[model samples]
Target: MTTGTSKAGMMMELSHDSTLRELTTDQGVLRYHEAGDGQPLLMLHGSGPGVTGWRNFRGNLARFSEHFRCLVLEFPGFGVSDPADGHPMATATDAVGRFLDGLGLHQVDVIGNSMGGFVGTRFALDNPDRVRRLVTIGGMGRNFYSPGPGEGINLLMEFTENPTRERLVQWLYSMVYDPAMVTEELIEERWAQATEPDTLAAARRMYGKAAFAATAAAAARSEEAPLWAMLHGLRAKTLITWGRDDRVSPVDMSIVPMRTIPDVELHLFPNCGHWVMIEQKAAWESTVLAFLTRKDAA
Candidate 1:
């Protein structure tokens, strides 16, 4: 385990036993974390500037690992993953698909959050036979309104300065309805990761990409979007989890898809925000376990 004070003097606590492996994809070396065993379950993180598999799935890893082979991937340009040559979002789905293939995983359950959710959905559409089931938490890739200046400005500021403990607490508070759930340790850990030299630069690069903004803008313009179309075509049993209080993606986005997809099931977590898995781990884990188990039995 690497332990030291980061550039911002925050004490970092990384997993000493967490093995890092690389998958040589056409894009580059894609780094990922793996734990436990059983049916394979690939976890994809959100689209935050500094988001990685650790940031999104840290809290629920153990619970899911008990039931499945959990593999968490750091998307290109995030965490330890190498950057892709083209647009970030455009290449992400392909990179992820190749990573799965490298694992010799022909079909696996995919659980994605936010941007990861969007990418996973697209991956399923493009390679339906490779995915056994799907779960999306506060996913994007729809024609929703863009973030306003307030949201954009805050994101820009986070790219420059290391997010203070207070700032992280505030961010989570805004994300979850119950502010009390924002623990001191949670805030500290996130602050530590966000301030790391490698992570900070990766975050800056993501934020600096004009392609990311353009892709998001373009995604917000059409009703019959790729994600929506993909949702309609998904053959795998699907679960859509949303934070009732999520301001980022909003729970309303799940309405149309839930109604349209016959195999899709939707769950709304009250008092939760964008990071539902982190904020409501117990409920989230139970829901996922039950769903995956039932599907396997069938």
Candidate 2:
């Protein structure tokens, strides 16, 4: 890792070399951020225009790193990491396996946000012995009371298709219950990354109208069961967190996992939105840290 500095709000006092690392796996060149040392804690980021592992979990790294070796895996197809062929979600799920194999980490504790939560759950189901514990922040399970493709998702698709500053702003605002959380610096940073031609193209592959139709069609043809149906098979002790006011992948979407996962706990933050970790940083970090450190019955 090369030492560097930048004004990205997420970087804060974090120097590049101390955190950023890369591994060349068969899947691709995987980029990640590592800090401290202990039992591995692999953090996965959500799928969004300009979303990176750093931006998604940087706030909680300092706290998490103190007790664990924090590895924030930047999934492929995101601009911060190498882009891959095929649907971004499938690429991300595959990247997790290669990332662990390349690093020689047999098991880890995982904290996943939104789409990351979905990916983590899939991984834990597929490799039960490899995940010691799991923490998910929104975007797991199927839609319950809320409408499918919630408000924030619509805004995200709009931004992906148009690539306009205005649309990005709209989508950013919808991510949190408090609009104040979407600052000019955040917008500027996200806009610069999100509009990159390659990044925009990747986003289109995941959120564009054509991509949505393709995803639905592919799902209809596949024989594999949905994540909700597979939750009961997960062996990891799980903590599911959600913002009561989330517009994208609303709180209702957490219902299935909360009920079906055999070893699970659910915590809902009032007045919070999709970005629960950011919108309720202190409380969330506290909650997760406690759960991760708790002793499991023999």
Candidate 3:
């Protein structure tokens, strides 16, 4: 309902693939991109700095739009969306509910990545009736399993300490199987966003919030945590994907759900890192397309 934005606040322009729009909610204004016309597929992004829905989904939107109406959202306190005002920071799970309600989407196919995956999993457990299907990539709500040696985990630490392009480039390399996959343009774009004032401010609030830290930590527990405790509550048929090399979420984390969830399947990609859609572009897109279109689990 409101149109005003600032250099460090709401986004000033739209990406090439979708129309940028704003929606008013009781919590705050949500910034998003929309395209195509079919069953709504709500796309959620990871917690990476400067991660907007567009920036994350721009690659897959074109293909996905062929069969589904894609609504990519930048949650409150991320990207150009307004901060939560007086309300405490909203978890991705809670934010998804409020965000969809603002658009009158009672039900939709939900897809999420990394932190987004964690949020989607929790949402499926809590609001089974609202999610038609659930898909997660390197999802983090579950606990970390037997963490092996080489998942490129130190990359995050290295970047945190230095925050330089070289460090970021190194971190990006850790995200994929091939070093060449991390392009210069991509690095430049992410570096700019990761260092921007709005992104940095939001990161401080989000990473500092107790709720966020608790969820991530709870997910680290294989047993006795709310995340794992509610696994059976997920009613939607679910698909879990992960980069076998994903050091951040750890491929091992997928093991718990494999044993616990009722109707779920896990797909692992070799030579891939945290960003599944990017590292394995063709396979990721085609597999998801098939999954979303398929009527049976087989």
Candidate 4:
């Protein structure tokens, strides 16, 4: 492991157990963390302030890695990855495809959370042959209710509009079922990342994109549709997981995919919030492993 100096004068492991590395993709530099070995399992993180794949999946990575070759990416415009020059979602989706192509990965089982879920949904829709098993947690673009933004989006807007550690902490608190999970270290780490000059600038651009989306949504006819998803087109064996108390993406939203997708299973974690993998680490990882490894799945 390579040792690096920190602002606090402590030596930190830059690569941290050989799990961290960078690869060049057609989209540019792609950073990621990986471990274990078997069928490729790609995990995508949410779009919360300062969100990183490591931060989002650190708790569950070890267990999941034990079962499969785990790869978690830092999406473009997030973390250390290069910023996007176009639509963030499309940019991310393209980067994902390019990343896999660069690695010569033929097929992978994908698990996406929140914004990552949105990316995964589009990826599966566009590149169905590239994915073998699919899992989406609290994914966006749903119709369990009206898809106009919710508490999580509102909180994110507040953070981007105001840009404060206090607001970021509050946002994190609202994302989880238990306040105990909002530890000081976690808060500090997220705050540190959110405060980076370039990252903060990227966030402002994202906020503008979100605002434009909201305006377009307001002008659209309410009769247009109750949802926006391509669930019917996805051919991968899928497991849609949600937390019962999740306000970000409601539990009932699972029904949309379940009814539309050809092959899908729904699981809800009672008393949990948007961060199901974090709060229900054991159950979440085990359930996902079983689904991906099932003889009938891939």
lDDT of each: 0.71, 0.87, 0.72, 0.78
lDDT of 3 by residue, 1-298 (tens): 1233332222323345337778887767888888666899999888654567777788787677667878888876665677663222344566788888888889999899876777787787778898888888885444455554233445654454446788777777777677787787888888888777666556555443453456456657746556766687788888888888776677777877777788888888888888898888789888888788898646
C-alpha RMSD for every candidate: 6.8, 3.6, 6.6, 5.4
Cα lDDT for residue 82, candidate 4: 76
lDDT of 4: 0.78
Colliding pairs, model 1: none
Q: How far is candidate 4 from the true structure (C-alpha RMSD, Å)?
A: 5.4
- Residue-wise C-alpha lDDT for candidate 2, range 230-270, written one tens digit per residue: 89999999999999998898888888888999999999999
Residue-wise lDDT of candidate 4 within 120-204, one digit each (tens)? 8778878889899889888644545646466777788789888888899888887889889999998888998987877777676
Question: Which candidate gets the maximum TM-score versus the true structure?
Answer: 2
For candidate 1, give the lDDT of residue 135: 92
Candidates 2 and 4: which is better by TM-score?
Answer: 2
lDDT of 2: 0.87
Please report the candidate that would top lDDT against the real structure.
2
Residue 131 C-alpha lDDT in model 4: 92
